[model samples]
Target: MSEHYEDDKSRAAKASFYHAYFSLKNILIGSYIVLSILVISIFAVVTSKVTEQIITEKENRAVINSLRNIDDRITLKLDNYGTVMNSLAYSESTQTLLKQASELSNQRQLELVNEVYYRMNEVNVTNTEINAIQLMDLSGKKYTLNNGNYYMEGLMDNYFESPLYDQVRSLNGGLFIDYSGAYSRDTNNLTLYRTINELRGTRPIGVIAMSIKKQALGSILFQDSDLPLTSLIDISGITVIDAQKELQGTESAISFNSFTDIASSFQTPLYGDNYFITYLKNKHYDYTLVNRAPIGSIYQDVAFIKKVNFYLILFNLLVVVIIAVFLSRTLVKPINELIGLMNRVRQGNLNIKMTNPPLNEIGILANNFNEMVTTLRNSVPLRKEQLIGKLLLGRTADSGLLQQAKELGLPAFDSAHGVAVVEINDRSNIDASGVSIDDVEILLQSELAAIHSSALLHILDARRVIMIVHGEDEDIVPYLHKMLNEQKNIPVTIGVGRFYASAEHIHESYLEALDALNYKHLFDRNGMIYINDIQAYVYSYEQLDVLEDGIVHAVKYMKEEELLSMIDKLFITFKEQFVSKEAMNRTIVNTYLKIFKLMSDRGIDLFGSEQSNIQVPSINNIHLHAGAHELKREFAAFLQSATRLIEERREKRMNETIAGAIEIIQSRYADNDLSAGNIAKELHISENYFSKLFKHETGVNFSQYVTTVRMEAAEKLLRQTGNKIGEIALQVGYNDANYFSLCFKGAFGVSPGKYREKQGN
Candidate 1:
């Protein structure tokens, strides 16, 4: 009996457990459906709000843009109106009409007035907005046209007091909106656009005023839309005018006041209320276009959308419940598999493979996961290796490894090799090509790798290629030839150094290479030269001194032909003496050093000490080891220095010559015949030389100096004695009285007569 009871209890417990599991499943599904409905409903509401806002903003912008377009059209019309009015106001007939107004008989005057009125009426008929047009004289007289007839009235005593007349008189041309005019009570209140212009040269004519109707202006605003909410007001909060009509009664005043207050504050538009206002201000006219529309009209669809959204939420909740049940069952197996695979990957078992089921979406996700794992596994080693390489390279500068070669018995120099300094001229005019500095350096290193046995290539301070080659090579000529031919795309030239036995002697070799390279302009072919070749042909100090003496003698005699001949001789001597590569380089370095020293001594400061310090050391090495390649370099440097020195000396000597000439002129001031050409002839110099010299020394040309000196003498005579103006002119070497007075007035900022009076005072 006890065993039977136990079996029955076990069956009951199993049934109860299954019931609880099914009940929990239903609850979870139901909860998911409810949450999803809530989320979707919230999303629908937010989307509706965003869409409504976007539509409202876009509508307001469209309205504002339309108003601006209307303003532009009106501005253009006004400008055209101004042009026509200007033409009419300046017409000869209008001047004639004004002149005959006061003297003619009533019939004759009316005829004259009608002619003027008819002309204006013709303009008015063409411009429909211009209801009336009139011309008023400065005396405040009024003239009106009635049914093709002209009627004239005597000057209105209070006409000048009107704001329209005040604006017309003050500005000569203006536009005003008049509240009290002949047509004010009617729909056609006056918008007087006036212009004042001169007639017959001397007469200050009255204004030609065109009175445009207020209703016509209102028609411009109402033409596009029948919307009852449009306004135009000046910036001062005054309603210049609007499309709304003024209603009669006690309520009218209150309504108008409310509108005026609202318009003033509605400078900027606001939203979300029952009304939406869009406003645009005119930059030229002090007026604003205010457009108001009902918010309900813009977003009328929101109410229908809200009701539809509520029903959609209910329908979506029902669908969500069904989808949740299926998704929970379907996602369980795949999620378990993904979790297992992730665990394996985390435990360093990256090679694990999972069978992809025939479910299309799940199969794709599995494939992608596998691909990602494979990529990360493969990339790890490569990234580690790259990091190591970067670490090593970063520890040293680009050229730091070359320093170690010297310690290993390889040749190195503190000074630069002149011939090895090849400037890489940029011939390709492309502003930007994507080539990087690393790419250029890599290319250079690859091309120079084979030559590293005898030479070390380095990038110098500038964008120059510097090559330090072994000076001991029996035939560097082959290497030089190979470099020139191989590096054709990159123009290169070599300055070979004399053979040196020790690393310390590398400086001498460097100098030789530099010297040879300096003569690159002279050599058309790839070649090499010994340092001894340069020293043999360079100019001695005595030779340079003799050249200097020749230049001085030529200038002293004021002989242009002789001076030119000396320059030619100097060039020829330089060519003959230092034509070799080594001589040329030595001469260049020496001349540069001398010029640098000269500038330094004279406090000119040609170059910074740091820059000069580096350059001078390199230059000294080239000079110490003179070579055949340096000859051309030496001659070029010598010529450059010689030219500069000669020019400076000539300038100084010319100044001295001019000062002497000036003294001669001052002593002979009484002689009116004293002139530039005569002075030059007496000094045994050419007239051109004399003129140049005079200008250089006195800061004035020869003729200008003579005139200035004579003028000074004239000033003294005018102040010291009461001489006649004509006599003063003659004393100052001027034969013409007018010419002298004119010159005096120009120099003193006053007429001669005025100047004499001021002096007396």
Candidate 2:
């Protein structure tokens, strides 16, 4: 009985432990709650300490950056204004106007003022913030230019007598006044005053004043409404700008306590409220920028941050508790579901799916599994298509193809079969028509089914699809035409080959189909071409040689008419001789090659046409044409362009040659041997060609032109000096003095001596 009680107690303990182990969801939630509380408590303590420091540092950095930004903008704007003033002071026009200010007449001084007024107008227009520009000479006479009805009244007539003038004059730089009260309506006016001294000497010439609206300075301040106060104070403790316009020209509220640094931040009281102050001294101007904020706002931000951090920590702990429970339920469930899915896939069930899967690694595994199954499901048909492609290429054995075709539900092979290639004439046309290769294939399959013919279709590429049809007597051309008529939007060309007696020769029919398709240029035949219907012809090499020579000769000499006629004759000859397509291709290629060779041999730069931007047609462009008519048209256009280029080249060369001949004539007219023939020999041209070309270009025969040049020289000699006719004759390229006199008389209608005597008279 004692041993029985011990066994029962041991069983009870075992059952309790197993019961606790089974309730894992509750255990996990409880553990997470405890851990999150401890972690959040520790985190809160550490974060509170660090956050204050970080917030303080960040606020300081942001305030400093704002100060720098304001400083830079003010400095840049002020410097620009200063530069404009300097330009005016040192300008030649300004200097001249000022120097002659006293001695000039009324009109002259008015003219000078107009010059300076135009300069002032430009500055005022560009810097619309400036109110007025006033120029005062040494005698206190004022010249002012204003824009948009902004004129300064003389409320401060004693401005020159004030200490401000003395202050600006004492220093070499400009001085800024807070409010000049120059405008009667607006008392808050900021003016820049400087003495305009002679740039070359130190003598003071004039005082120039520029007035700006106070709001312009206010606009440059950092626009933060939270700040209680911000001000720009001069070194003399006067406020130049205040956010409140009433404080302008008043003494600053907060004292610096004599901190002599460029920048300082401290806590101070302003108007009974404790405030934090940040100040930066401007490097370019005699001003200090000061910003102040209430001390309560800073502590409020810190308190708000601490409160937000505590709430955030509590919210995170709650999320961790919820997540622990959720993961305890969901993590194992998805993994198990994934394992089951994988098993089903392993069992050859590719249609299984996991719905609303958890977003974790298991979800990725499930998606990949689905994709893998889909690929496996599609691989059979893909493999069958590949096998058919291989069969058409003669890369697969007939036995293997038959077995795979049977298993893959492909059309069975037959003893007599033929391959037809249906090529889309233009892929763009198909895209424009909203039809695809699949649509065309389905149409073809439906037509084949309608005709009760067994066939297999595979899209070879984007533009072409190949069909292997069973039976020797089945004619697929009519069905292809039917499909073409059904789909009027997509244009197609069908090349059907003769049926073979064995499957092994299917690739031969494929090749033959492609061959028939290429004959679209010769016999389009309404886009339905058959191998057996195409007629082969023998070409004579001698005939091709004659045609090629004619074409090349026309292109070489740039004869457009002859080239067109030759191109026409080429096709005509091909038709008359019934030349094969291959021979026709060879003929066209050989013609282009020979023309290109001629261009190379003659050093003709195809792109040397400066008069026209039309590029010479590339020789490779010939291969782009697929039809006889288009090829003929493009070839004609190409040859025409070539003719124009060659003509331009020849014209340029002829002009250069004529110019060279004229240069030789000018330099060698005194040689006495500068005949057209001698010059032509030097220019590497025949005398007749040179003479005719020269007359055509210069509107004069070579001999007459030469004689004209000589007579003009002789006439100059007679008028300018006392040289005799014989000496001038030798100087002007005439060996015989008597002949020179006769030639000169013919040119001038007077003998050389008579001309000289007439000129002397």
Candidate 3:
């Protein structure tokens, strides 16, 4: 009885569990179907909205582009018309005709006016857009021609009476639009579009006006469409305001109010019962372009889009139903497996392999997934190694590995005994040929060759190349010399610093290299220099003062030969005291700084412009420890430029002084005691000093200058008066007649009698 009851209870429990499991499965399926419908509906609405926005934006752009195209065409036509008018109005023949017309008889004047009209008609006929051409004088008188026939009497005050006339007149030269009714002809209802251009002076001479056909402008507004559009309405709300149509045209009388009310009542682009109204603002005319498009006609495309969207939605729903069924079964397992693989990969275990079980398409997908993992596993190490190498060579800044390197306490330098900074001067001239080499490559090759060992090289910046060399050899000089000579074509300068014991002291070596390079200007052709060589070239500060005094003395005395000799002596003394490249460079750079400073103190600008306002790099930053030869060459070039500038300034000052002296001499030429000695005494200078100064300033001696001035006065007196030669000579500060005659002969290259006879007195 107990066994029977237990079996019955077990069967009942099994039945209940299966029934509940099936019910849960049905509930999950129903939830999925409802969620999927909601998601698909949301996606469809978003997609439709996005598509509509894109289409609307594209249409707006198309409209703007079309308007711009039309505006460009009209602008071009107006520009061409203005150019023709400008050419004719400023022509030499037109000026000549106008000039002749003023003085000619009434009959001749009429003929000349007719000729001018004929010329204008020819220009108009060539341009089909131009209906008529008219020329008007400043007095509001118009002379118009139509098909070579002249109309002289019925002159209208079109531009002269308009408010735009003064604005056009103010341009002085160039064309401006005159919106006033200037030349309104009857045929074709053509109204005047005057392009008034002024002559190249203060006065307004004439105006050029064209009668533009209204139909030509209307065609531009409407273009290839069946739509009705009216364009170029003025600020006063008038259509066809600046039109070329005559007063008799049917479209000319159409008021701006007729369209302005209808356009204003509708939202910018109003689609109405039969037509859609739209308007574009014309910036050139400061007006509006109004158009009316057939409403049902223009929106036919919009209606088609609606119909297409409805069918697309129905088709999309069918696709969604199939996609839901397929995705529900396949997505969960593949997605879970992919997540696991990604987690393993992220953890650096790229060896993770996915299993391919034969069940639907998941087997094929699993095979592809395993292949991807294998490729990634094989490539990661190689890429990481390559990336590390690139970072060490300064090709990249790998912050991750760099941080790791720092944390691991990796040595910044390999067992380097010393650091050297090698810089390539005139790097811009480097030949970039094989391997896309640049100035940096030239520096790298030169440094490696110089060290002749596996030294670490780094590009610090555009201007500096740094290297660390291992070993304790004190005589790195020979290697440096050979390296520089070998790479002479590159024109690189190597600055070697004092050897440091460890990597941490590399900064000290860097400073030494910089110091050595700074003193490079003291040397000649080979600029390879070492910082330790500077002590040999040290000099007392007093010696620099002596050098300054010597330079100034040479300049003041105007002794070029003596200056050259002094410079040679200084160079020889420097070479004797300091034989190394560093010493020579330091001396050269110091000398330049001293000279420039002296000039600055004396209020002399070495750069020709305002030196005070100019900012130069700090002197410490300037690489001076280049080889002695390079230092010397750079200094020499700088000195040459400075010397030329000084000479220019001196010449300008001398010219001013000479001009003043000449003015004084000319004003006091009648004074009998106006000799060189007397002039020197008056100016408070020695007679000899004055003579030298005068010759230097004017390329003439003081006595010769005085004689020349006196002779000029004598010639002027002889011409203006019936005076004897002796009297003229005496008046011009020549006392003794015989002495004056000799002076006169020297001054004129002839006797006073011949000079006076040559004057035709």
lDDT of each: 0.54, 0.71, 0.55
User: Which model, 1 or 2, shows the larger TM-score?
Assistant: 2
Q: Which segments of candidate 2 are over 4 A away from where they belong?
A: 1-50, 125-127, 173-187, 222-228, 305-761
TM-score of 1: 0.34
Decoy 2 TM-score against native: 0.35
Q: Report the C-alpha lDDT of model 1 over 595-695, residue by residue, as the tens digit.
A: 45544543344355633422223564564433333443454434344444544554655555676786776676546687999999989999997787677
Model 1's alpha-carbon lDDT is 0.54
True-vs-predicted CA distance for residue 289, candidate 1, Å? 3.5
**Counting only residues 3 or more apart in sequence or on different chains, how many pairs clash (N, Cα, C under 3 Å) in candidate 3?**
30
Model 3 ranges off by over 4 Å? 1-27, 96-101, 125-128, 148-155, 170-199, 226-230, 241-266, 269-282, 285-288, 294-299, 311-313, 316-721, 724-761
lDDT for 254 (candidate 3) = 32
Candidate 1: segments with Cα more than 4 A from true spot: 1-35, 69-84, 95-112, 125-129, 145-159, 163-172, 179-187, 199-204, 234-244, 247-274, 315-761
lDDT of 3 by residue, 1-761 (tens): 89999999999999998788668776788676666666666655654565455444433433444455456555656655654565567554455444344666778756766776666655552455665566666555555655333232333455566565765566544445423322342433334343333333345566665565555656776673533343455445544522233322223233445444312312233322454444566554444555444545545555654555555444546675664565555655665786688687665566678765446334544554575567555655444433333432233233454434333233344344566776666545553432212445565566556666555556544556665566554455446545554744655567887776544456567667766776555555446777777665455444544444445445433445555555665566565555444444455556667667755754577565654433332446345433434444444445554555556555675765466667778888878777777777777878887778788876568777778778767756866799887788789887777788788787656787775665457
Top candidate (lDDT): 2
Give the per-residue lDDT of model 2 (tens digit) for 325-437: 77567656776787788787665566677888777545655555565566557666656666776677564453467766665666556578888888887667679878888
